[model samples]
Structures are given as structure tokens and as C-alpha cells.
Target: MGAKERYILLLIIDSLIVTFSVFIGYYILAPFFLQYTMPVLITTSIILLISHHVFAYVFNLYHRAWEYASVRELMSIAQAVTASIITTYILNILLFQTTFTRLMIITWMMHLILIGGSRLSWRVARHHLIGKQSSDQEKLRTLIVGAGKGGSILIKQMLDTPAMNMLPVVAVDDDSTKQRMELAGGVRVEGKREDIEKLIKKYDIRKVVIAIPSLSKTELNEIYELSNHESVEVMIMPNIDDVMSGKVEVNALKKVEVEDLLGREPVKLDTAGIEEQVRDRTILVTGAGGSIGSEIVRQITKFQPREIVLLGHGENSIYTILEEMTGRNNNIEYIPIIADVQDRQRMFEVFETYKPNIVYHAAAHKHVPLMEYNPKEAVKNNIIGTKNTAEAACEYKTEKFVLISTDKAVNPPNVMGASKRVAEMVVQGLNQNCKETTLVAVRFGNVLGSRGSVIPKFRKQIEAGGPITVTDERMTRYFMTIPEASRLVIQAGAIAEGGEVFVLDMGEPVKIVNLARNMIKLSGYKEDEIGIKFSGVRPGEKLFEELLSEDEIHPNQVYTKIYRGKTVSYPIIEIEKTIKQLENNNNIKELLLDFVNRKEYTKN
Candidate 1:
């Protein structure tokens, strides 16, 4: 109903209740109606009606959404009725010269019951009507994984919103105290997380939602494994911030992603240190169009930099990130430069023109197998590109230059890994020669969801229906999210003391075959349905990837999830000579590997 119509309806209903309560009190108190004059009774009824509405207006009883009434609404109704009764009792003393204290108390009791019941009935009726209508529509039977506040809110939202087409049949919580307890919408906590499979079958659950916001990645992985049924689609509640801010409804559950099962807590950045260094500083990020590069650019913008120079070879990628950054923040200057890092003159010109305070060199040839086929391209991009960028930064006297290295750089096996190792050497060597700039390298493992990563490839193969290919059944690689990788890169810049090789703790190496199986399950498919094919190990690929070499290992962390490696310093002349010889060498891959693996370069 319209607000005016609702208000008018409540006003009329309240008038009748007020009038009836006064006369009913009189009738009950006086056995013979003749004890009170008709005029006195009529005057008492008028006084009660006027006083009730005045108090109702004061309490905003008419403005409340009665269809969702609760204890608060009942309290408002009681206050309004009690105030009106007290006012009527005072008027009876002045006009009739006799206060009807007994009658006033009886009337007050009647008013509370009638007004409060009327508001509550609306809520009950609406729920019943919604429930009856929901029975006619097809709804997915869902199982909630947590019986906490989040789960209760989700259940209530699903019940109230029948259009959502989700019927929360039962909830499962690991808390023993909450076992067999009922939550909002009368959904019972049937069992614990381990009983997910059994409860799904028992309830005929078609969907499962993990509603625990504070659940650790390890616990989430466990719950997901138990709920991984082919027929039952699993989803998770949105982040707590998104729900509390009203950005999305409590019932808006998102699909469970493979990233959620990584079982590693995100590395917390030293925000104060990062902000002190990056805030209002001119920051330059090369390869800003690629996955990790773009993410680095995004994270840097949060610190409110004075200017950001997005330098990349690809125009489209640079333009995409530029548009996104511009839309989000107009105060910070976003300058997109379309130039290759390998172009030495252009790099120098760009650096000299911008004179960025900090430089993040992210442009590199990262694909292992692809780099193996074209080793020359890997050298030109990863090694020479990093050299050109680092030299430009040193020449321009940049405050800090961070080289985005990889785990592949540690005891490298592939051309890509070897090239990145050379790139790291280039920066460490430059750090010694240039005292004005603090140069460092941050090495991490495979970034999930990056271009040509396993996760995206697996998703595509699953979408095509069956036969997800694994390079090798025994192969393992450390994995981290792009944002996590990027944030650590920025954090490394904050903690960089010249020439330190900062190694990110990738937690543990995940077996490729197990990762494939999990992806298939997350996509709502069985192992048999999405058949896994062994492609065997490709050229330049290793059975496992490492974050740091034995010589570089540091037992203690300099920061949370960040380790500063004891790296060997190479003569800048020898590193430059290797870069010069690789341009025309027929055996570039062998030469590159030999240069990086030399034991003599170790600082002893």
C-alpha cells in the first residue's frame, strides 16, 4: 500500500481500538451501566482516542514497517498506549472529579494487547503468504555450512525473498554447542562439516553455501572437499565488507574458486612503510598491461601516488589499465607510455622525462615452454629488457628500482628461468655501481589466473567438455594470487636495502594432478566426467619449482611471508658481457644457464 493509505488505515484501526478499550473497561468495572453517566463514558472514549493518536505520532508507530515488526515495534506500541491511558486518567480527575484508576489500568492492558497484536499479525501473515507462494515455485534445496550470524542472515534473506528460488533446508556447523540448533527461517544445524556429504544426500541438497566469513583457507578447503559433489553446486558467501556495506545482499553467494583452496593465508603488507615510500611519489611500472604488472599498478594507486607512469610494449593492455585507474581516481595522474623496455634510447628518454621516484620492472618473457622454443626472444626481453630499464632508472637516479623476478630464477632449468636470473643479476650488479638508487629483486612462484597459467587453461578445457591436460602427473609448482604477488612486490620495494634478493614464501608446492582434480570438482564435475590426460613433461619444465636456491636460503623472515636472500654479487662487466654474447649465440639457452649456475660467483 502507499504510505498515505497505510497511515490512514492504521489511524482508523487505532481509533476504533481506543474507543472500544475505554467502553470495555467501564462495562467490566461497573456491573450496572447506570453507575456512570452516558456523557461521562462518551467523554472518556473521546479523550482516549485523541490521546492515543498523539502518543502514536510521538512514538512514530504509524511510520514503522509493521509487516516486519518485532520486539522493538511491540515496545513502541506499548509506550504509545500507556501514555494515552495516563493522559485519560488525569482528564477524568479534572472533569468527573473522580479518577477511574481501576478502569484506566484495565484499559491500558487491553490497549497493549490489541495494538501490539495487530502489528505482529501483519508480519506473521506476510511470512505465511510468502511461504505458501514459495511452495508453488521450483527452488534449489540448499545446505548452509555455517550456523553463525552470516548463515542466519542468509537463511532469513532466502526465506523472505522467494524470488531468489533457494530453499535453505539445513545448516552444518563444526561447533558442537550449535548441533541440532535452529537458526533463522527455522533451518536446523543438522550436523558438523564432516557430515556434509551425508546431510546433502539426506536433505536432497542441490546447492551448498559456506557462510563463514572468518574461515581460514585451510578450513575452507576442508569444508569444500567434503561438499564437493558432482550434482551439488557449491558457493561461498561474499566478503563481510561487501555484505555489511550493502554492496550486495547477504544471500548473494559466489561460486567457490580454485584460489580459495590454496590453503595459504594472504601475506600482510607493511602498509605504513609502503605508504611512506610510495605516497605522493612518481611511480613507474613497466609491462603494466600484463596480469601481474597491471595488478601492481592498481595496488600502487591505493597509496595515492603523485603520478603513475604505465610503461608497456602493448598499447591495448596499457590503455585498459589506464582507463581503469583513471575511472577510479582522478586526483592521481596516470600516464600511459607505449614503449618497449628493450628500446634502450626510448627507455632512457622516458625515464629522464618522468624521473620516477620508484620503478617496478614487470615486463618479462615468462612462459617456460614458449621461452624454450625461442630462447633469443627470452634473452632480448627478460634479460636485456630488464637491463635497459634498470640502467635508465640508475641514470635518472630513481629512489628505488624493484625487479619482478620469479622462482624459476632459483637454480633455473628453462630459458625463461635463466633469463629472469640474468635480469636479477643485472639489478644486483647495478645496485653496487649506482649508490643513488636502491635496486632489489623480488622472486615468487607461478601467479594463478595470469595469462597462460594452469588454472585458466584448466577452466577452458573443462568448458570444452572433458580431457583436462596436465603437463606431468608428478609435476609440482608453488602458486600465489596475482594481487598477493603484486602486493609483495610493493612491500619488497619498501624493505629494499640495495641488492637483496627478496624471496616470497609461496607456502608449499601444489601437485599439478591434484590441482586439476580440484578444479574439476569446483566446476561441478566428477573426475570421470572431466577425464585427465597426461601430456608428459614438456621441454624446460621441471618436476618441481623452487622459491630460493640452497645458497640463498634465509631461515628467518625479514617481514611476514617475506625473506631476504643472501644473494651472490656478480661483476657488472661479466653480466654485461653475457648479455652481449647471447644476442648472436646459437646455444643461448646453454650459455644462459651456465652463467647463472657458476659456483665461483657465490660470495664466500
Candidate 2:
């Protein structure tokens, strides 16, 4: 039916309900209300029908879609019923000049029940009692991981819309008291979370839905690990607040991504402090199109910077990030500067024009084996690039300058690590000399899912159907999500002091072989189905990586997940001399070692 037809049909139904309710109320109170004549009964019925219809229009009840009815819709029904009854009571007292007060109470209850139920019944008939079919083999048998609010809502939505192609057969929760309780559509809370694998096996489940939005990352990791199976697909609900606010539907659950497995407790940032540091200020992000740099720009945009300068070497990368930011129409000015950080003159020119209040230098040579083979490129990019940016920031009298360093820089094993160490020293040296700018280095570990990261490589191999390569079974490295690392870097800038190397608390080191195995399982393949190969560690690659050197003591934690390490002071002359030697034809590895150690310093 058309909207007008539906509205008129509902109006007619509501009119009948109002009249029948008043007649029933009069019949129930007939003995007590001895003064009830035919005229009085007729007048009360007329009053109820007219008043109810008028109030229904006021509440916009007939205009609403009953198929999507929820709590708000039910509340509107209640308001209309109450208003109509009150209006009828007043009309009866004035028009009929008869006190049917007791009868009015009876009529009110009956009218509310009949009218409200009449409207809500359509929703029930549409969602719960209509078009439901028997469990079919073609439909996916789904398991819900939580038996809480989110889970209940998800089950209801699924049952309401069978076109989603998933049938919720069971639910599990950690709350022992809730065991054996039935959620909507009779999906029982079968057992505790530990019984997931058993439940999946018993039910022949094909899909797992994590419906607890408040679950900690640690708990999520454990659940994902338990649910990893060749036949099962995993999905998760969005944040609980979003679901409750109608910003997201319970049925709109997303597939679990690689970053979710490494998620930790959500970081709580110092928004006020960050705002004070970034708001209304000119910000410069070097390598802004890169993984960490791009995330930094996105987060910084939330603080409403006056202007953002996207500085990178490649034009395509710079153009892509600029378009994304502008397409959002964030209303913040973005200056895209395609300049290589290795060029000192270009860095100076950009800084001179922008005069950025804060500079986040994320440009560096990160891939270890590649940097080891081309040591000169590593030095020129990681080391000299940093020096150029730092010198330019200091020269321009920037308020705060942050260099993105890595865990590899802790105890050097490769040219990449040594170059980062030397870059850290350059920042320290500049902090000593330049009194105006607050120079600091933020050190983190491997960023999960970044370009050229192992996660992507393993995912591709899994998709290709064989031989997922791992450097070694024993090799492990600390991992943090790109957003987590970028946020920490911004936090470090906010809390920076001159000459401090801030280290983020990378929760724990994850073994590469285990990560690979999890990826295989997540891909719905058994280990035998897709073989894992142990390629021996490559050149300059260590069996493990370190976050901080043994001699560097982390005496204070500046923020949650952020620690301040005691600064290591090296002579500026020694650093400059090492750079000079690196410029000429010399043993790149020896010069890098001497630069990092300062023990066997030789003047060029």
C-alpha cells in the first residue's frame, strides 16, 4: 500500500480500538456506575474515539514505519494514549455533566492496552512472526561470542532480517550466571567463552560473531585465537556506544582485521595538552603520505591545526593524501610540498615559507635488508635527512620537533638501526645547541599492516595458496598498530622536553612463526593446506629486536604507553666527523659502528 493508504488503514484500526475499549470499560464497571445511561455511554465512546485519533495525529503515529519500530516508537504510542485519555476525561466532565471518574480509569487502561498493542503488534507480526523459515542447510550457522546487550540486539536484527544469510544458533558469555539463558529468537547462552571451540564443533558452525563491543584487546585476541578455524569466519560489532546511539546497526558487523589481533588497551590521549600544542598552529609532517606520517596527519586534523604542510619526496603520494584530506572538506588549509628531506636546501626553503610551529619528521629508510645492501642510501636518507629537517626546524625556531625513530635503533644490528641511532644523536646534538626548539625522538617498533610489513606479505602468500615464508621460528619483534604509534608520536611531541628520547611501551614481542600460523588459520586454511617455509634470516637481520639499549635507563613514564629514556649525550664534533668520513669513500659499516659506539672515533 501507498503511504496515504497505510496511514488511513492504521487510522481506521485505531478508531475501532478506541470505541471497543470504551464499551468494554463501561461493561466492566456497569454495576458500580449505576448512573450510566445510554446517552452517557454513547458520549464517552465518541469522546474516546475522537480524542484518540486527534492525539495520534499529534504524535505522528500513523506516519511512522512500523517495520523498523523500536523503543522510541513505542514511547510515542504511550504518550498518545495517555494524552487521549486525559482529553476524554475533561470532555466527559464538561459535555455530559456526569462524573464517570471510576469508569474513565477503567477505560484508560483498556484504551492504552488495545491501542498500544494494536500499533506494536504490526512490528511483532512483521519481524518475529512473519516469513520465518525452518533452519536450512544453505543458511550459515552462526555463533555469537557474547550473550550481553550487543549480542541480544544482533540476534534480534538477524532474526528480523533473514536475508542476511546467517542464522544465530548459540551464544557464549563469560558470566557464569547467564549460562542457559535464552536471548531473542531462543538462541541460548550455552556455556562459557572457553567452550567456543566445543560449541562450534557440536553445531558445525560456519561463522563467529564477536558481539561484545566493550571487550578488551587482550580478551579479543584470546577469543580470535580460540575461534581460528578453517571452516569459520570471524566478525565483530562496532563500539557499543555507536550501536546504542543508532549510529551503526547490530547487523553491520565487520570482519576482523589483522590490526585487531595486536590491539591493546585503547590509548587515552591528553587532548587538552595536544590541543594546546597543535591548535591554530602551522604543522609540518615529513613523508606525510607514508603509513605513519599519513596517520599522524589524519589525527592532527582532529585538533584543528591552522595549516598542515604535507612534505614528501614523491609527487603521487603527496597528491593522494592531499586529495583524501581535501575531499573530506575538513576546512583546514593543506600545503603540499613535494621535497626530498635529503635535500638540505629544499628543506630550508619549505621551512622558510611555512614557518611551521611544529615539525614531525617521519621520513627515513626503514626496510632493514634493503638498507643494509645500500648503506649509503640509508645514511643519506635516515641520517642526513633527519639532520636536514632538524637543522631547518631549529633554524626556523619551530616550537617542537619530533623525529620518528625505531626499536632497531636500540642496539644496532643493521645499517638501518645504526643510521637511526646517528639520527637520534643529531637531534640530541641540536637540542644542546639550539635553545629555542624542543627536540625529541619518539621510538616505536614494527607498525602492523604498514606498507612492506610482514603482515601484508604473509596475507598475499596465504591468498596465493602456498609457502608462507618466515625468517625463523625463533625470530620475534615488537608490534604496534600504525595509529597507535602515530598517536604516541604526537603525544610525545606534546610532552617533549629538550634532549629526551621517548619510548612507547610496545606491549610484548610476538614471534613471527606464531603470527604466521595465526594468519594461516584466519585465512581458513589448515597448516597442511598451505605450507609454511622457514627462510633463514637475511643479511643484517637479527633473531630479535630491542626497544631500548641496556645502558639507557627508562627512569620515568611521561604518559600511558609512553616512557622517557635517559638521554645519551655524544659530542657534536664526533658526529660531524663521522658524517664527513661517511661522505668520502670509506667502509660504510665501520663508520656506522663508530658513529653509534663513539669508542673508535677517527677524524676524517
Candidate 3:
């Protein structure tokens, strides 16, 4: 309601409360003690009620904003009552000569009781009875997070008018100062965040509503980890400013996403580092349709580079990303070149014509089992394709060249891994003498959902109502999400001393079978209902992957969560011989096994 209408309704309600309160007080006490006329006492009571009601209205007591209300409203209540009692005292002393009578005490009690009760009753009645859902069984048994301002407001909002079938069962806060405090509507503070484990178990709580909006990302990540463990669903209330601005309602709570849990301090790009290199300069990206490549395009475009060349083999994928890019950002000039990274002549022409100042080489034959069957293809694309690009960049004198490497490249047990390792060596090798171009290799582990990644496969399998597949119960690999991997790649490139191989610390390794089980549970299926199937290991696949070989260790870390590996420099003449043979021969069975460590490269 508007301010004026709300004031009118409140004034009428408080006046009715005072009037009834006087009658209840006089009906019980007036007959027993007072020798005054029964009609006189009531008439005096009615006069007192009118005076107090008017006083409340004049003080704007009835129109106090509930959200802004606190202890201040209670003081206003006391003032309004005292105002009426002083008038009563004056009239009794001067007009009626009724000094300290039992009826006066009774009326005083009624004034406090009825006035306070009227407001308090509305709070209680609205929260638990009238505002609550008729079918109380629909309630979700929710737990409010902080017992502070936001938390108290949320509890009141939930009690007064709950949405989505949620009941505020408990509230928690770490502030020892507020441990025993009670919010309105009888919602008491439970304990602290540390009490969640016991509280959830004791109350059978299924939902946790995080009302602390200004908490940092790291803290949110920690809380999310705690919530995900017991399979408790979590929702976070928006910031208070959003609520105040009417941009987001009290009801617009958001779900905890992976980024909320997994992200680091958002990378503060070295603007001088980027602008110094990218401004008014040409940039090229291979595999531009892929996850890392596309994100790099997005990031690079933000630098206002002279031109961004999106180079990829897949026409449809390029067109889709191009369409999305255009729709979101219209000012940047982008040229989508549909060409394979493996095609030397095409890449050479594109590079020479564009003379890209920065080249992000993300293209490679990456599927481990598929590369095992087609080792020759792995050699051509990963090793030779990298050679072509590196050579072309050197010829064109590109200032910075970043090669995206994989964690599997470390002591690789697969053709795909070995090919990437070889590609890194090629970059490091060329950097030895190439003064015009600075070639750098940044390696990371498996991304969560790149093209052909297991996340999509698991999702598809779950959708199909079939078993989720895992290679082996013991197989494990490191994981970082795609955007994370992409961002780190950019950061790694910007920091590289030429030929340096940068690796991200991917935390602890996760087992594949356990990963599948987690996915099944996250999808809301019981383990018995959606079974897990063992597919056996694929060719050249390992039970676990590594980020560094024993010999290539960096004792001191470079970035907080990333490391640099000791370069395993190859003899230049031997690399030259291998490249010569790689270019001439159609078959690369032995050299592939030798370099890629392909144990399953035997002829079919």
C-alpha cells in the first residue's frame, strides 16, 4: 500500500486495539474495587483510549516502516502510552480526584498489554498462521545462515510470507555477541556455521539459505564445499543493495554454482602487460572454436586489438561462436578464418598476410585413445603442425607465441600426451635461437568439459537412462574447469620467459569411478538405481596422469597455484633429423612410439 493508505489503516487498527483494551481492563477490575459509577469508569477509559490513539498517529507510530524498524519502534510505543497516562494523571488529580486507584493500574496494564500485543500479535499471526502456507507439509525445513541484519530480515520474510515451500527451522551466526538473541516472530539464533554438521543431522535440515551476501569468494567456496558434502542444497540471498534498489527481491535467491566454489581471485590482468603487446596489433588463435581458444578470443578482444583472427577448421563451430561474439559485443573487428592448423600452406599464408603480433596455438590432436589408433595423425597435427606454426611465426617475426600444452605431456604414457610433449619441446627448441619470436608453452591438466570431455558424456549417459561409464575403478586424473584452464593459459602466456613451460597445480587428483558416482548423485539418482559400468582402459591410457616428470621439477613455484618445469632441451640436430623424417614419411609408427611413448601403437 502507499504511505497514506498504510497510515490510515494502521491508525484505525491501533485505535480499535486501545478501545477494546480499556473495556477488557474495566470489565474484570472495575466491579470489584472501584466505588465510582461503572458508567463513569468506562467513559473515562474511552477518553484515555482516544487520546493515546491520536498520540500514536501524531508520532507516526502506526506508519513505521517494518523493514527499517528495530528497537526504535518499541521506544515509540512507550512514548505513546506514557503520553496518554500523563493526561490520565492530570485529569484524575485535577478533575476526578481519583488518585492511584486500582482501576488506574488496571488501565495502565491494559494500555501496555494491548498496545504491545497488537503489534506483536500481528507479527506472530502473520508469520506462523496467516502468512504461512495452508498446507504446512509443503515447507522445506530451511536453515538461515547469519543471525545478523540480512538473516533476521530473511527469517521475518520467510515467516511472514514464505515462497517455494520453505520453513525457517533455525538461524546460525558466528558472532558470540548475538548467540542468545531472538529475531522477530520467535526465530531464535541457533549456533554458528561450525554447528552445521550437528544441526543438519539433528534437525534433518535439507536446505541452507546463506543470508551473508558480502562474504568473499573464498569463504563462499568454503561454505559451498561444506554444503555439497552432505548433499544439502544451498541458496544465497542477493546483496542488501540489490534488495534496497528493488533490482532483486528478497525472494530472488541464487543457487551455488561451480564457479562460486572453484574460482580464485578473478585474475587481475596486467593491463600494461597486455596493452603494451596487444594494442593496435594483430592476434591469431588456432582451434578458435574450442573452449580455451574461444575464451582467449573473448579475452583478447577486450584489449581492443587492431584485428582478431579466429582460425579453426570447423566452419559451423566458428560460425556459432562468431554469432555469439557479435551478439554480445559489436565494436570489435573479427575475421573468422575456416582453415585447419595442420595445413601448412594455408596457415603460412594467413600468418604472413596478417603478421599477427600474438599467436595462441591451441590446436592439437588431443583424444588419447583416438590418437593411439591414428598415431601418424597425432604426429602430423601435434608435432608437425606445431612445427609449421612456430616456424611461420618465426618467419613472420611474431612478438609472442603461446602454445597450449597438456598435463598428460609429462612422462606421457599415451600418443596424444607424447605428441603434446613433443610440441612443447619444439617451442622450447625454437626459442633457443629465434630472436624475432618468443615461443612459450603453458601446460595444464584435463578441463572439465572441453570438446569430447567426460562431463558431457556422463550427462548424455544420465539423460539416456543408462549406466555411467568409467575406464577403471583406480583410474585418476587432475581436473580444472574450462574457463579456469583458459584464464590460466592467458595468464601463463603473459608471464612466460621464452621457452618456459608453465603448469597449474590442479589440487588433488580425482578418481574416475568416484567422479562418476558423484555425477550420478548430483543428478539426483541413487547409486543402485543408476548403475556404474566398467569399460576397461582404452589404448595408451594410464590409471593416473602426471604434471611433471621426476627430472623436470621446479622446487620454487612461480604463480601461487602454478609452477614452471625445467626445460628438457633436445639436441638441435636430432630434432632436425626427426622433423625431416616426419615431413617425408606418411607412416610414423616407430618415431611416434619413441617420442609419444605410445605403448599401444602396434599395427592392427
For model 3, which pairs clash?
Answer: none
What tens digits encode model 1's per-residue C-alpha lDDT throughout 56-102? Answer: 99999999988877677898898888889899899989998986888
- Ranking of candidates on lDDT, top first: 1, 2, 3
The better-scoring model by lDDT among 1 and 3 is 1
Per-candidate RMSD, Å:
3.6, 3.8, 8.5
For each candidate in turn, the TM-score is: 0.87, 0.86, 0.74
**How high is the CA lDDT of each candidate model?**
0.89, 0.87, 0.76
Clashing pairs in 2: none
Ranking of all predicted structures according to TM-score, beginning with the best and ending with the worst: 1, 2, 3
Tens-place lDDT digits, model 3, residues 424-460: 8788889877898889898888887788888788879
| C-alpha lDDT of residue 358 in model 1 | 97
Distance from true location, Cα of 350 in model 1, Å: 2.6
The digit string of per-residue lDDT tens for model 2 on 186-286 reads 89999988999999999999999999877788888888878887779898988778988989877788888767888677699999999988999999999
Q: Could you tell which candidate, 1 or 2, scores higher by lDDT? A: 1
